[model samples]
Target: VCPEDSNDSSRFMDLWYTFVDPYATEVDEMGTDEANKSVGVLRIKDGRKIIDAYEWKHDNDVHLLAQNDELIIYELHVGDFHEKFKDLTTKIEHFKSLGINASNINSYFFF
Candidate 1:
């Protein structure tokens, strides 16, 4: 549903039905048993296929930036930040509430 190629329509539909749909049921069925988990497979019309599937759990304590050490040193774009947050003051407040340290905000710099 996220604007994939029209050539792989059937594959996309299968992916949506297999993985996206009944996500809760799949997660519940899998539970804490990693070995018993059913991995979703995607088969393209061109014969290329992918088997790995990932689920993002909503954990408020886990920050996206803190997930990987590589992300810590990376600088985020100002325009993207503004577009994502909408308001500067509210964004700053949110960051503070999330225990993010104050850093110099450079909004004028373009990538």
Candidate 2:
């Protein structure tokens, strides 16, 4: 359990809970309910059913170029361009030849 000071209720209003159930396909929610009002994360692991706390992990491996203005941006819609990242990876050489250093992709790129 987290220290009371660390889990300060006043600062964190949204109670995040992870429901892990191998047989469950969707979360149950009613907009008015307290659980529904907060965040509910669905998790699939080994083989279990329970509620767990959610933690955020920041990506420290990403390196951005110092010169942002020099970046060559390419807007792409994953769904429209290609269904999956594997298909997009196949065109990496093409993008490199076109000088596309960065891309703005749809939020559902992994979907």
Candidate 3:
């Protein structure tokens, strides 16, 4: 669809939207209905478009560098570790005793 086809070029915009079609490579959140998703782009290395079919592949796990193996990693759950700074301070000695040189935590959705 084009703006000129709409008969009001100034007010009309040529908008394109994708839906959960059979040709979709993958669906976000596994939505089955058309209105709930957007399709991935299908194209060739030479810029040719794929119109009839799509091949879906699951993402592969990324392999970390060799240096990653050398690091001492201590995984911790921040919310479970402590409720406040004072509480955390009380565990400093315990943490030090663990002899862990590094720590990683994910607390973004802890509510």
Top-TM-score structure, candidate number? 2
Q: Model 3, range 15-109, lDDT digits (tens) per residue?
A: 65655557554445544765555555444556764554555565686755436666666776656755564665677677668765556766736
Instruction: List, residue by residue over 29-71, the lDDT tens digit for candidate 1.
Output: 4434554455533345567544336666676665444444333
Q: What TM-score fits each model? A: 0.24, 0.43, 0.33
Clashing pairs in 3: none
Ranking by TM-score: 2, 3, 1
Inter-residue clash pairs, candidate 1: none
Please provide, for model 2 over 13-35, each residue's C-alpha lDDT reduced to its tens digit, 9 standing for 90 to 100: 55676544455544556358564
- Candidate 1 residue spans exceeding 4 A from truth: 1-76, 83-86
Q: What do the candidate models score in CA lDDT, each in turn?
A: 0.48, 0.66, 0.58
Could you tell me how far off, in angstroms, the CA of residue 95 lies in candidate 2 after the best superposition? 1.0
RMSD of each: 17.1, 13.1, 15.7
Error of 3 at 67 (Å): 5.8
